[model samples]
Target chain A: MLRLIGIGLNPKKHMTLEALEKINDSDEIYLELYTSRIVDMTLDELENLINRKITLLDRKTIESEFLVERSRKMKVSLLVPGDPIIATTHIGLVISSIQNNVEYEIINGISVQCVVPSILGLQNYKFGRSVSIPFPEYDYYPESVYNFVLENRKLGLHTLVFLDLRESLEMSALMGIDILLKMESMYRKDAIDKNTIIAVISKAGSEKQRAIADKIERIKERDLGPTPHIMVIIGSLHYMELEALKKLASFPENENINLL
Target chain B: MLRLIGIGLNPKKHMTLEALEKINDSDEIYLELYTSRIVDMTLDELENLINRKITLLDRKTIESEFLVERSRKMKVSLLVPGDPIIATTHIGLVISSIQNNVEYEIINGISVQCVVPSILGLQNYKFGRSVSIPFPEYDYYPESVYNFVLENRKLGLHTLVFLDLRESLEMSALMGIDILLKMESMYRKDAIDKNTIIAVISKAGSEKQRAIADKIERIKERDLGPTPHIMVIIGSLHYMELEALKKLASFPENENINLL
Candidate 1:
């Protein structure tokens, strides 16, 4: 039997009561940190709370037949950062478990998906398709992020731009903005310009959560403080949304902010 | 200070450890039940766990100045089903709190938006705009729903059809499909037909959660059991998604389901 649980945004603040019980019941507990980071707790703190030695699984281990073998014989629980199935890879793993006739359960938790909008006091319905902005590999700069922004902007919907997190190196919002700016110049499309107001949110759903709303050009120079940052490209903002940004988050003075 | 907490889907299985602690620490605990229901636990069971009598607030009470007034001077925790800020009205309230200088904290939980996709093994990236189907109020069939389906289908994206949950009456998937069918006839846009494959999910994120995929006409005959039923309009499906529906969920035999 395999139990996949989401510990939510903050380890101390968000673990569900059922997740805690499952951690106790499982014969072996493994934390899959390759996908996302646990922003709050350390491995020692987590181990202390669970009262068990937790084995951390890298990508190689997770992709191997080790999890399947262990689950087939003993109760195994894999702890995910957010909701277990938010990532397509996790969904693929569950499908694999189904093929192996392994009984499994998914315990969902809070992801940056809804929490980011909630923290900013924006309507979830207004958010369109979310896209990830990865660190450009040699001669492989993806334009999916730019395309997603353009599509969302056309529908007057907000776009959630997730900066890529690779191992210990997480892409910064400044670099993400730089990529978009470069993409704009290369494509020569007016999807993202200097005047565009972008919201850079860091450590969302955590105690140190910070949000900054400013023009893209201006944001490229500003430090967003720490890793795990996401950007929201502004579409048509409601008056209340504008007000929420102004009151709760840092929004620069701009007369042309309300496109709605 | 006011803390708006989402108790997740199932009370017994989904409530977070932090949510429970906040419920105990709050000067006043109010359960907002107008937007969504707690499918697994009764009111008595919830109250028993909290060790405090919770006042259930109706729509009128929630919209009124009661919550804001109470939170102004005391620590109030409003227990909302699923994520606290998933609803737009909650965003409005939080904005009001900000205007009144009332400090508030939002605790995120497992939302149906992510959970449904996770349960059905549908890629979240493929989900387009989500729309709710309200019961027709005699000569008031919303063309917006028809338009949304057409738009989403054009983009090759799945649509999450949320059934309207009026005060005491929760609309089922069968009734929702009926509304969409009538709208299609009225608009004649070819958005959805009798042969359209829809995923009817009931009691989502619960232990007895059931998902059935079939043509609309066949789904209308079967009882999905209980309130809080949601439907997913299929778009392009990955091979793994088709396999998930066949193995994880109950789907009628269809060669056309694999759109990968």
Candidate 2:
């Protein structure tokens, strides 16, 4: 049996009761932090909390058939940072398990998509397609990120921008903002500008989580204080939503930030 | 102090350890089932599980300043069915807490948005703005539902359609599909038809959860079993996503369902 469990955003406190029970029942447990980093708790602390030894698996190992094959013989569990299948590769494992006739169960966990919008006081129904901002290489810049934001904004829908996590190094909010600026420079679509209102959230769902909404220029100067940051591009906001943003996220007063 | 705790989809088992601990420490605990229903466990079972008497609050009470006012004098907790702020009125409470000078903390939980896409083998990032299908009144036909689906489909993004719940009555998959079909008739748009492919899920995050993907006609015939049904309008599919849908969600073979 293969048990795929989501540990949520906070490694220490966000795990569901069923997820904890399943981890305790598993014969062997493995975790992967490469997909998304959890800074609140160390691996040793996680192992101690669950009272089980954990084997850290790399992307190669996870994508490979080792875990599935091992589960065919004995129970194996994979502890994911968020809801199990947020990463497409986890769904690949589900399909593989079916093909190999390995019984598998999914225990849901709190996900960034579920938590961030609520924390920022944005209605979940108003969010558009979420996009991931990647670290630009010397010659690589994906236009899809800009296109997604443009499309969502065109329809008066908010966009959730996921900062990239590559090889244990997380893309910071500053880096993400810079990438959007670069995208704006290249596209010249007026989709994003320094005057545009945006939100930057760091360490979401943790005690130290910070959320602030302001203009791009002002946000770039503030110290968000950590890695694993996510961004939200503001769109048309309902009056109640605007009020909530001001109260919960420190969004600038209406006189300071203009939507129309 | 006020704590907005998310009990997730299943009332009995979907709570996080932190949520459980906070509830135990609270001076009083409250739960509201009108926003959403939990079929896996009864109210009595939930009280027994938490070892506390729960005062059930109505929509009016939740929307009012009653909880915030109560929390000003004591530690009060509102046990939400899913993630707390998914319901916009909860954010109203958060703002009320701020206005009343009451401290509040949100403990995230598993949400249908986080779990349904994964269960259907759809990528979370590919989902567009989610829409809720209301229990249409005699003269109430929401064109926004059609427009949202149309916009999302045009972008080749999947749409998560929430089924309506009114006065402790839940909207079934059949009702949602009929509503969509009626909208299609009124709009005469090709966005939805009897042969359009879609996914219907019921009792998500529970032991008896069921997921199935097929044509609208076939899905309409399926008894998704119980309340809290969610629908997903299919969009462009990645090859791996299509495969996973087939293997995990019982999506029909590609030859049987035509995308173009």
Please state every model's RMSD to the true fold in angstroms: 1.8, 1.7
DockQ of 1: 0.67
Which candidate ranks first by DockQ, i.e. highest?
2
lDDT of 1 at A180: 84
Q: What is the TM-score of each candidate against the true structure?
A: 0.96, 0.97
Kindly report which residue stretches of model 1 are placed more than 4 angstroms away from their true locations once superposed: A221-223, B221-223
lDDT of 2 by residue, A215-239 (tens): 7888877777687788899888877
Tell me the docking grade of candidate 2.
medium
Pairs that collide, model 1: none
DockQ scores of the candidates: 0.67, 0.80
TM-score of chain B of 2: 0.94
Tens digit of per-residue lDDT, candidate 1, span B9-90:
7767778778888888899988888777777788999988777999888888888778888999999988999889878778
Give the per-residue lDDT of model 1 (tens digit) for A1-260. 98888888777778888888898999999999877777778999988867888999998888787887799989999999877886777777888888899888887777878688887877787777788887889856677667777777777778888788888798888888888888888776678788887888888766788888878768766667777887888877888788777766777645566557
lDDT of 2 by residue, B1-260 (tens): 99999998886668888889899999999999877777578889999989999999888888887899899889999999888988878888888888888999888877888888778878898899999988888858799889999899889898998888888688888888888888888998778877677888877877878888878877766666776678899888877788877876677675454343
